[model samples]
Target: MAKVNKRLAVLVGCNYPNTQYELHGCINDVVAMKDLLVKRFGFDPTNIELLTDASAVTGEGSSSVVLPTGENIKAALSKMVSQAEAGDVLYFHYSGHGTRIPKPAHIFGHDEAIVPCDFNLITDVDFRQLVNQLPKGASFTILSDSCHSGGLIDKEKEQIGPSTYRAASSLSYKAKNIPFESILEHLTTLTGINTSDIGTHLLESFGANASLKFLTPQLESELFDFLKADEGILLSGCQADETSADMNPMESGGKAYGSFSNAVQ
Candidate 1:
């Protein structure tokens, strides 16, 4: 067994406040996960980077808080991976909406992605690239609590999310989902460039902030570029075709939370 040396983490939660994509429980999810990592797992608070909505995580501390934008999130991941070595363990947890490409799938089946607060997508190809960069003996684990997140790691099959056999519930439930059409509409409205090509819209609007994986499709050489074993792990909330839920449980006094995240905790 590999003797783990240091434990590092990045926790992201995006509520997208006041927008049509607004969620109610992601902030709470990251905060709770932070506490769990500190108390239950052995993660140093200083070594972990927490990203979420500004208004939600206020009064938590005086540390420099970063918003969960695509650029910022990617930067955080890169920073953590850059510092890792053999026997080190890294963890990433995302609580937010997820999406998938409806046409010309990048990886052949579906190109799943996580929708950052700014709507700049971080796709499975991006995650694959990040994983390929990990140093040997370094283990990176991802826990994604978002809709259509199962394929966030290219060709991942660890599907575990919502089920049709869900017990009856009267409380409100919000799907942590942003359809391709909605994303296109939002981008078109922002850039005034009506095009079905999401990559073009993202490139026009966010530029460098947009995920390069989407902007530039991963090449065949790149796919075979980093072939290693046991360096990366993905624990997604649902299959590529499924949608997770942000739900208000009856026993929680009406405070909403992610169904998948809640179950995980």
Candidate 2:
């Protein structure tokens, strides 16, 4: 008998449509990965949940398209983890914008995050928490196809350079990250709230859409416990200081896609 497919996945693709932070290929990346998982990995169709922006005009995930909001993404991951047993395989693939934050208290000396469509910052702390909840012998692999994706799992060992987000020494592509301050500025323009405190403004504008990591800092001990979970694996697109390029239609044979995500596919 064929082995049962003991796999689950939460795929997220945020293009931030009609906004200044618009991306061209994130959704394409997600769709391609879904296809790869279904055909090659044989993950049950019912076991794969998709979250994307605007339901994807391509109609790939239109049947049950969940928006890539911060809460929805977190909840989906929670649900996947809750259903997993020992030795099961879990995967999270994020194709969107990513930004870095200055958090001296974090084990990494900073925080890396993927930018949900709503701009709620899901930090490394949150990913660590997710991994910690996984049952022993389970594996949660994360492929982040966005800028500053390095260190997304808090204490994961580094395999690349430019330890923090900064100007890449030399890159020819545009980074899918808005400076953290610029995100605040954008919110200010729309919400008419001007403050250096990102958590405050995000709470005001996006409300519950904002990430809890910004609102409530997890205790150091709790964070330590989260990091101690060794089942998490990270496939970051680039070093924190470097940018990941999203190929536009012109560059990708008339189909837009994230460069890193395409390579993985």
Candidate 3:
């Protein structure tokens, strides 16, 4: 294989329209990132793929681009990674809703997943799998501006954080844990898949951190093992246990945007 020196980016933003979890700033965040990549990083404009609920028009006369579905996003990522050779740089940026999903039956920890426009989650396990496919000397970096994104690349060591979020004295942010059960229910509702393995769900609920636990060796594997990847790094918006904010700040003149994404831009 030819060792090609290329820089590729896949930027995804989702403002879930007509839904209870609607936000106003995700697409804007990706657009700003694209501009930064082109003007500052010297990334070729044609090499970037913009996927968002809103239209992306590269030039005045260019046609508006349609949003990507979950399958489309997966296919793009697969192609991006599969095409990489040594000395390639792959960038993935996501500004959207994120949540925790119970790891599939065989894996022990919970999965941190990005919520796609279609509600089909792309989990950290998926990302790790992709990173594993990267050729030697290739690198993947991800910036996830979403909730529960800390471990978004699976077993990678957290070099920057587990940092605490401290807003000004007047502003307060509280973190809440949504039960994994609810996520399973949402998945089932959306795709009619039987996500509930009742026996395993009950066992996982008993606190994986508990000292006195009754679980078989197989169950133990579900709590402590993860796929390790050496080629990817994740910069997440919040600690795994915290929630990222979708801010509608006054400075933006009444526009909603992801606070982390705005800061990065």
Candidate 4:
């Protein structure tokens, strides 16, 4: 195990206030993670940034808290990575909604993305890009408690899976299908134009940085290059082909909780 000279965390939780995608336990999930980092990992309270919709409710005295909008989340992540140095341990925990977008014409299957409160997405490519910014000897760990979160770290090897059970390292698993209608609605929000054509329209309107372009073909060497240089681990709630349950059981004090988040905490 690598000793951590410095400890930092960026925890984001979203309840999608007043929206159709409202969730109940995301804020609680972040709270739990914040507590764990403070007590279990010995992270300084000042070194953690908690971004969530419940900032007003939970962040009474914390000046560093903010809402989990796409812009805010991205900026917080950038700051966390920018401030890290060698031998530091940085942990990012996201407890919220996730979506699977259609892969580009050149690629096979799908790509995974976390849904921000604004419905703007942060995809796996974006994460790998962030990981690339880490200084040597620094480690970045991601814990995603959301739907379709598997492979969020992009081409990182699997230590536990069908591959581990099989004779060799290669094992195939089917990815879950996310509705195109839902994906299109969210993607079109930025461009204000809706078209059945995904590739051309998104490319023309939003260009490369567009959320959907994360699935588009890129130089594998550069996009996945962090796997070679960085110590990053992604612990997802469920497999790519599985749905994670968000349970609000009456027996559990009528409070909602992500099944995976509750289990991990």
Candidate 5:
């Protein structure tokens, strides 16, 4: 294999302080991702940095620090990305509760928002800003183990997941559906897959793929194929209609199942 460039991993778990409202599964997810990078992908443990609610400042190999809110999150991200250079791969993994806010004026031109932490809500525009800050040729991989992430799929339809106004007032957002209109559009033009055929193929493949029981084969295949395109990869926990479990009944003080963290573990 050709020599691989240096890689930096940022793993965050939000289960402790400052995030009481949102369950913190980020720490576990980060730890599991770290193990995968080191044991399976040959990444040097020294290159990894983990931030959670329980760690201290060590500045050593794969150290952990506690972050309670969004301000701290932005600062840490800025610092880490500053160290990134060409040919570098930056892996960002976040596991926690996701809140929606009214859409921002710049992107959606409506009222929809997702709270990233106690201090601030992360809008699509905010995410785009972060992405724009990255150096060219740098690969950015983001895995979000939370609800309402389908918002990343398209800006036009900010209202995904069963209409937020329906029954069971406790459930605010739809948990497991990925709106693939844009993805289908892109694939259709690029690969000549008819839109209708694309949907059929995606459905068939997502439903049949057994590796991930939570996702239909068509969705799975679409996501897998989409990731292969190399633009960006997003792996959510469940379909838009389903709710991902947060606490595994078998474990205590640790996050539950339905989180992608369990799969990564």
Candidate 6:
């Protein structure tokens, strides 16, 4: 008989303050996952961690922590990777909004980003970079309940502000101010439909990296190889163009599971 291994789970959900933009219902998903893992998978509660917006203020659970900003997220991920041990299973869940930024000169060489919150956004390259850093021989599974989260797409044209216009124009002349609505329309035309391909592509790219090593036979070659290169599994909530819905109405106080969460439960 094959040996059974211990697992570590990290659950996260975010609802940005002052905005109803976060419709993914990540908190409920995390909670549901926590219950399912305990009830069905027989995972110890002590092995799991949860991070969320409210938790940032309340400071709950041993494994559960809160991320107040983008910097906090970076630090948390770094800590999580550092804490991982070989031969252990790691489950990570993230539910929130994804945004695109103007690609920088480094990786992918195009402007794209995933909207994280008010102050932070995660680019495709940035996310791939993080995934590449995971330890070997560990089973890492990730569920991202968000959209348009795929690979780098040019967002330079989508940027607005006097400084951007001036930089692009090279001070040729003070042109009449352009409307943001017009720019958005232009961006839509240029990018067509922004899909979740960016996220999948990033995962694929990471999985393709040559340095990955796999330790389990049950793991399929393609999926394993891809993840070894990238080192994780991401079960996204929907396709690139689709939006993940909140099962509960905003006014309701009772917690509810998202479609993916409900299915998992």
Span of ten consecutive residues with least summed lDDT in model 1: 55-64
Winner by TM-score: 1
Q: Model 3, 223-251: lDDT tens per residue?
A: 33544446787888888767887766545
Candidate 4 whole-model C-alpha lDDT, 0 to 1: 0.70
All-Cα superposition RMSD per candidate: 3.1, 4.0, 7.3, 6.5, 15.7, 15.1
TM-scores of the models, in the given order? 0.89, 0.86, 0.77, 0.80, 0.57, 0.57
> TM-score for model 4?
0.80
Per-residue error for 133 in candidate 3, Å, reads 0.8
Worst 10 residues of 3 by lDDT: 206-215
lDDT of 5: 0.49
Per-residue lDDT of model 2, residues 225-245, tens digit only: 635637888998988766788
Among the numbered candidates, top lDDT falls to: 1
Q: What's the count of clashing pairs in each model shown?
A: 0, 0, 2, 1, 29, 25
lDDT of 4 by residue, 10-126 (tens): 988887768666667778777877887787878898888888886534333553357787667878888989988988899998888887777655466877788777655677777
C-alpha lDDT of candidate 6 relative to the true structure: 0.48
TM-score of 6: 0.57
**lDDT for predicted candidate 1 compared with the true structure:** 0.83
Collision pairs in model 2: none
User: Which residue pairs clash in candidate 3?
Assistant: 108-222, 108-223
Error of 4 at 43 (Å): 1.1
* lDDT for each residue of candidate 6 in 1-265, tens digit (9 for 90 to 100): 9766677776767765454353435566777778778878887877766666654321233334455344455555556666666676777666665543322235633333334343344444444445656677766666666554333221111121222211121111111112223333433444464443332332233333211111221232333245434445556555333344445544445554455556666
**C-alpha RMSD in Å of predicted model 3 compared with the true structure:** 7.3
Candidate 6 or 1, higher lDDT = 1
- Candidate 5 residues lying further than 4 Å off, grouped into runs, are 1-4, 16-24, 55-63, 104-117, 153-231, 238-243, 251-258
**Backbone clash tally for model 4?**
1
